[model samples]
Structure formats: C-alpha cells, structure tokens
Target: MTKVAVLGAGSWGTALAAVLASNGHDCTLWSRRTEQAEEIAEKHTNEQYLPGAVLPDTLKADHNLARAVSGASIIVMAVPTKGIRKVCRDLNSVLEGPVLFAHVSKGIEPDTHKRISEVMEEELDREICQGIVVLSGPSHAEEVIRNQPTTVTVAAKNTEHARRVQDLFMNQSFRVYTNDDVVGVEIGGALKNIIALAAGVTDGLGYGDNAKAALITRGLAEITRLGVAMGANPLTFSGLSGLGDLIVTCTSVHSRNWRAGNMLGKGKSLDEVLDSMGMVVEGVRTTKAAHQLSKECGVPMPITEALYAVLFEGQKPIDRVELLMGRMKKNETEDLAGWS
Candidate 1:
C-alpha cells in the first residue's frame, strides 16, 4: 500500500481521504484548522463539511502541511482551484521526497485561464516531481461518502502517470479510467460546472425537461468549442470528463453549482446565492472567467454569455431565458460558428 497525503479537509477532500484509507493506503488528511484535523483524526468525523459520513480510522489528520505530506508516494490535492497555488508553494518548502500528484479540482484560473495541471507545474517547478494527474467525473462528495458506485477518469500528460493513479484509486465502487488528453480532461471538468449552473437557472424558472435537454445538448457544443480552441482533443469532450460530468452536475441535486444557480435563477443576487450555499460555488467565478475567455479566444458561447449578463450585468434572469428562447434557429454551425 502506498502512502498518500490529502491536502484539504472539505467535504470532497474528506471523502477522498475516506476512499484512500479504505483502499488500504496510509492516508493523512491535512487542514489549515488544526481543530478540524484533530476532530477527523480523533473522532473520525468532519461534522461541518461531511455530515452523516463516518470517516475511516485509518485516516490520519494533521494541521502541519509538512507533517501530513511528508514521504508520501502520492499527494492527493482535493482543494478548490483558488487555493492550489498557495498550497503548492507552501508544500514545496518542506517536502523532500518525490511525490506524484493527483488533483480533483475543477476551475480555470481567471487571470491566466490555466488548467489545474498548468497551475501545478507553474507552482511546483521541479523535473523530479514524479508526475501530475487529474481525476474528474460525475462523482459527488455526498454519494461517494455512502460508498456508492461512481466512475471517474484520470488524465495525465503521460499515460504512465494515469495508469499509476488508476491502480491507486480504482475499486469496486469507485472505478477510474485512464486517458492522455490532459487539456480536454481539465477543460471539460472546469467547463461543466458552468453548464450545471445554467441548468439550475432553467429549473429555477420552472422550465420543463425540454429546456434542460436542450441546454445540456447545446452546452456540450459550447464546451467542445472552447476545448478545441484551447488545443484539447475534440473527442475528449464527448467522454466522461466532458459529457458525463455535464450530465451529473446539470441534473443532480447534489451539485453545488446547480444549487447556486437555482438561487440565482430565482433572482437572488450573487452574494445572496453564495451566502445561502455556504460552499464555494465554483461556477459563479468560472462564469466570469469563461466570459473573458470567450472574448480572448474568439469563441461564441451564447449560453455562457447570457448567464454572464444575468450574473454580472444585472440582466433579469427570466428575461435572459426568454431572449435565449427567442434566438433565431439556423443550421447549427460546427466550429463555434459565431466565435469567428
């Protein structure tokens, strides 16, 4: 069994720690709050983030980033995207061993539009860093905590790295597939949250299944457009990280993005929605970044654009929906038609 370090104590991170420990790996869960770490270590519970899930006894916890991560064969990054750079920079100071990375984050850097792997490479800056891997799919912290069957894909620049992670996490309830399309995998994971929020908006407006079906179908088109524009394999968007993730997030009640969007669609302000959700609604920030990327990369994402208008420009949500519904039908162009 390999030793693994989990660098967050949030719901998703805690669930990941439980899985790693159940898989017979020695796992250390690290948190900035020592008390929270202490609670998980001693009581086997993280009452705030993951209610109703009993953590494994094998899951060790610590506050010191160095102590938790030291000498681990794999470092599982379960933190949000915004925290990755700071955590990596800090972890680099005390780590002496070569550690392979497996991150489950999903968001693009707003300023640079960098993928999570790019952010890792930028912060770590070591040739001997072992390898970098990204795992993403429809898995939610809630269901996975119940040991429900969930499937995910691991993508790395190197196929060897993907295979190694597959051995590390794949099991009876949690299955992992390997892929080499790093760009597509990362892009799909980040982009799907936006579509999920859009799905919630439609639901909030009381639109029927037809609207949601259209949004999911056409949203895949937009995600594919952006992924291809940014050098991802066109086919990857059709895979699990792309279409599979989109399906889960857009429909499932467990999706935080969908929850946040439900509030927004019901005419809640951004701050209000965020306050209600109590979790970092990644899609809110990603919508801003994606709107910026559409302009930079010359990609036309009408769905994203309308969502942005509702989110940032104070456009009424129902009005935006009506506008989208009234858009003229034409031959669906293949290459993000209006982007050019």
Candidate 2:
C-alpha cells in the first residue's frame, strides 16, 4: 500500500482520498479547519462539498499540515487553482523528503496565466518535489465517490512519474490513462470550463441544443488554436481532457461553471450568481485568464471574448449571444488547414 496525502477537504479531495483508502493505501486527507478534519474522520462525510456521499472509513483526516504529509510518498493536491501556490509552499515547508505530486485542479492563474502544475512547480522546492502530475478529464467528484465508472488521464513531463500516478489511482471502477502531453492535457482541462460557462448561458437563455452544440464545437477550435501556439499537440484536443471534458462540463448540472452561467443567462447578475453558488467556480477566474491568453497569443476566441464582456463588462448575456452570432463569416476549416 502506498502512502498518500490528499490536501484540501473539498469534494474532489475527499473523493480521491476515499479512492486511495479503498485501494488499501495509507491515505490521509488534510483540511485547513480542525472541525472539518474531525468531521471527516468521525463521520466519513464531507457534507459541505459532497452531500450524501459517504467516504471510506479507513481514510484519515488531519488539520495539521505536517502531520498529514509526514510520511506520505505521494501528495495529491485537490485545492482550487488560487490556493495551489500557497499549498505548495506550505507542503514544501513541512515535507521531510521528496514526494510525487498530483494535482486535480483545473484553472489558469489570472495574472500569471500559469496552469495549476506550473503554479506548483514555481512554489515547491525541487528538493521536496519529486515530480508533478496532473489528473484530469471528464470525471466528477460526485460520481467518483459513488464508485461509478470514470476515466481520467494523468500527464507529466516525466513519463515514469505519470505511470506511477496511473497505477496509484487505477481501479476497476476508476480507469486511469497516462500521457506525456502535459501541456495539452492542462490546456484542454483548463479552457473547457470557459466553454462550459458559455454552454450554460445558452441553456439559461432558453436556447436549444443547436446553440450549445455550436459553442462546444467552436470552443474546441479556439482552444486548440491557443493550445497549439503554446506548444501542445493539436490532436490532444480530441482526447479525454479536451472533447470529453467539454461535453461533460458543458452539460452536467454538477458543473459549477455551467450553473453559474445559467444563472447569468436567466438574468442574474454576475455577483448574484457567484454569491448564490457558494463554491469556487473555476471558470469565472479562468475566463479572465483565457481572455488575456487569447489576446496575447493572437488567437481569435470569439466565444471567450463574448463571455468576458458579459462576465466583466456588464454586457447582457443576450447581447453577447447576438455579438457571437452576428460575427463576420469565415471558413470554418481555415484555421485547421495548417494543423493537418
């Protein structure tokens, strides 16, 4: 049994910790709040984030950072993107030895435009971090905790490390795949949330499937364009992290981004939508970073730009939809011609 420490007590972290514990690994989940830690340990349920889901009894919880990571050989970071750097720094300060790190957060740093793994690398000491791996795809925490069949990919610059993570998480109900295209995986996972938000808006606006389908398709195009310019393989955009993730996040009620966008489309202000959700909608922050990235990379992301206006400039969601639909005509495959 491998020793694992999953940082953060959110739904994703708790679900992953349950997976590890069920695999007979020595796993501990760390929560910043002592009450949360006690609740998880004694009750085996993180109702705040994952209501009605019971965690594995063998799984342990701790509020102390040092205690949670004391003897762990693998550290799973499931905190939000904004918390990644601080968690990495905290882990580095307390870690006694180098450990493999796997992150499940999907987001782009607002100002730095760094992926979650990048943020980890920047904050973690090399001496304490053996490798960085990103675990992502279409999987949802609610389904995962229920032992539902789920597939996900783990990527890293170090193929060996990626394989190690694949083994650590793979089980009959949960399938794990490995990839060396870290850039593609990270980019696909992060940007899909933006598209999901737009998709949600479409639903809230009472638009039909046609509009949602168009958003998903065009969203993939722009995401691939930006990802390719950033040194990722274009083909990876068609894989689990890309198309697969987009389909699920854009349609599922579990997606916070989609739900938030739905509220916006239904006439709720951005502040009201955010205030009601009470969860970190990664897409809201990612939209800002993605808007900046598109401009910086010279990629035309009309959907992202429209969403940005509605989200930040106080433009009406209906107007944003009009803006997108009324754009000048261009060859759909023109941008993809060079890819082939």
Q: All candidates' TM-scores?
A: 0.96, 0.99
Best by TM-score: 2
Sequence-dependent TM-score of model 2: 0.99
Q: Give the residue spans of candidate 2 off by over 4 A.
A: none
- Candidate 2: Cα lDDT at 282: 93
Query: How many clashes (backbone atoms < 3 Å, residues ≥3 apart in a chain or on different chains) does model 1 have?
Result: 0
What is the C-alpha local distance difference test score of each model?
A: 0.90, 0.92
Candidate 1 residues 97-182, lDDT tens each?
78899999999999788888999989995943788999998889999989999999999988888999999987899999999989
Candidate 2 residue lDDT tens string, 1-340: 9999999999889988999999999999999999999999999889899999888999999999999999999999998898888888787779999999999999999989888888888899999999999999998899999999999999999999999999999999999999889999999999999999999999999999999998999999989999998889998889999999999999999898899999999999999998999889999999999999998888889999999999999999999888788989899889898565
